[model samples]
Target: MRSDTCQHTAIIGAGIAGLACARALDAAGLPATLFDKARGAGGRMSSRRLPDAVLDLGAQFFSVRNATFRRAVEGWHKAGSIAPWPASLWSAQAGRWQRHEDDLERLCGTPSMSAVTRHLAKGLTVKAQTRIERLVGSAGQWQLVDEHGEHHGPFTRVVISAPSPQAHALVAPHDATLAEACEAVIQRPCWAAWALFDAPLPALPGVDDDWQAVRVNDPRLRFVVRNQLKPGRQDQGESLSLLANLEWSEVRLEDSPETIVEALLDAFQQALPDGSRLPEPSALGAHRWRYAQPDVFAGGEAVNLDYRLSASGLSLCGDGWRGPRVEDAWLSGHHLGEALAADAI
Candidate 1:
């Protein structure tokens, strides 16, 4: 629970977790200041506009499982901002590709994946395009230090929602105990390629008519997505997105985008059925996620919050602790928010 003396809060990382935490604080009559290095909110839950189509180059889609996230999804659905994605999932194993038929309640933002997070960010005090390099405490309140060495702060509490490695860097200078927790967490990288073709692709077996996205066991490419197939996506010439396998992406992290795009497109071609033919793409590009996902660990135990430092007004939460999905991020932030609310924050 948050103390009444705890007034304004500073939240780093404008992704789902930070938004959820800010909303919770605001609900309890506490103000919040959100900070991120990006030009906009929704870290990896972002979308880019191409000449012909909108591409969700980050999070392809999300699924609702636990009640907490399901409740939020219902609100987004009623707001007409989200819908179930009807695309199929394919996984490759031992050279045999099998379709995933679990009938999952997959969800995605209507116009773009960031739409959901953008909706949650309304009415909050957000400092976009500003990166808070570190946190400092003075007198009693907490202060934020930007990369430019400027100071901004005097907040009651601080919540960090960045990736574990980034989070560790921020807190290690202040609290070594908490730094160890953040350092113990590791992450994986991913490389994504977006391409626009001249025409629509033929519908494949075991998938819907709108589009096709598959997970393959290729050397470079992992998942291939037809952007237009999902609900609320742009309808035009084919806009396909390819996600490289994690190991491959890590190995090629330093490669140029043009080089990566060519490799991925070639991998996609090789993944197609024998003798399948398609025209060359009109445009092609790539993006790299250096810390894309948390590396799954063997031990089940991990730190969630360092309340021992809470007396000094600091807390840490992020998807890097549990998972690297939308729901995981939301729940972690949501739980902290509820805790603060219970304390009458």
Candidate 2:
């Protein structure tokens, strides 16, 4: 057990939101102790290394719409951690491909999707593979107890940026009102199947030179991206990542990796153009995201739920309240971090 409240905060969940929040707090000259249950810090912005290729198995790309997020992305871009994905995009409507001519600024982390979070994690004290089960203590300051029976904190403030379900579990015994609100937040599951092929899908009319990613209207799959075409990725060989739609993912959420990979692969092949052929994949694996996207069926605004800031020193922020996007996650964390910084100072 460690008892120290030296103007430091315990930020649970080292995901994008957590990392963003901690970055803001650090900017204000405050220290944060970040904790995550995963072996790495990225959370849903995950990247996986296959026997033949490295894939951005989680969030393939994000559009920078917010001024704050744009500035942050620019800094990362200048630092060579991120870059604009100029490759064309395609949308499937009425079973036909439609070239996306929006020319919007779509960006992705260099090397892999997790690179952005890894860059933001620099100079921050993050505790990986440590799950802080329940928060204990009172009067605005609480200590966190890990699953290993170890104790940490006595911090002046705590910010929880985990998925709403997990965040509710941690804050429930302490604040029922906040927990009830979190229960109302809807999140859906998703799965990404990363498949490496000896031969890529044959070029169709509007593919290759025109589009590297496509949104499928199929019931089984939602998105497919040619991983090798992205900047900082392998220039040769063929790799594809298939993201399952919300409804399909919900039904197959508990399915085996082999089952999901096979199903998504079959669906992708079927969705391809009539003359195209998908080579039998050489390497195949899948990642399951239990809390993929916020249903957002209840809110019209991006920042739907208000952040929680108790006088007792407990705070909350995440994409759950701020809608579902990388930008929303960043904003939720940043706003709460700014408020916490002001109070601590």
Error of 1 at 223 (Å): 1.0
Write model 2 residue lDDT over 1-345, tens digit each, in one string.
Answer: 223337889999998889988999999888999999999799888788666677887788988877877888888998888888846788774346877778578888888888899999999999999998998997556899999989997887888888888888998998777777778888899999988888756777665553689888889988998888888876547898899999999999999999999998888777777666787888888889999888852222443444667766777788887767887787788878888777765
Prediction 2 TM-score vs. true? 0.93
Largest lDDT belongs to which candidate?
A: 2
- lDDT score, residue 43, model 1? 87
Local accuracy of candidate 1 as per-residue lDDT tens digits, 1-345: 545645778899999888988988887778889999998889889888776788988888898877878988898899887887745676653334466678578888987888998898989988998899877874257889998988888887788888878887888787777688777777889999999888767544444464356787887988888788777765566888899988999899999999999998888777665555556888989999988877752112256441223445676766776676788778777777767656553
lDDT of 1 at 214: 76
C-alpha lDDT of all candidate models, in order? 0.78, 0.82
TM-score of 1: 0.90
- Please, what's the RMSD in Å of model 2? 3.1
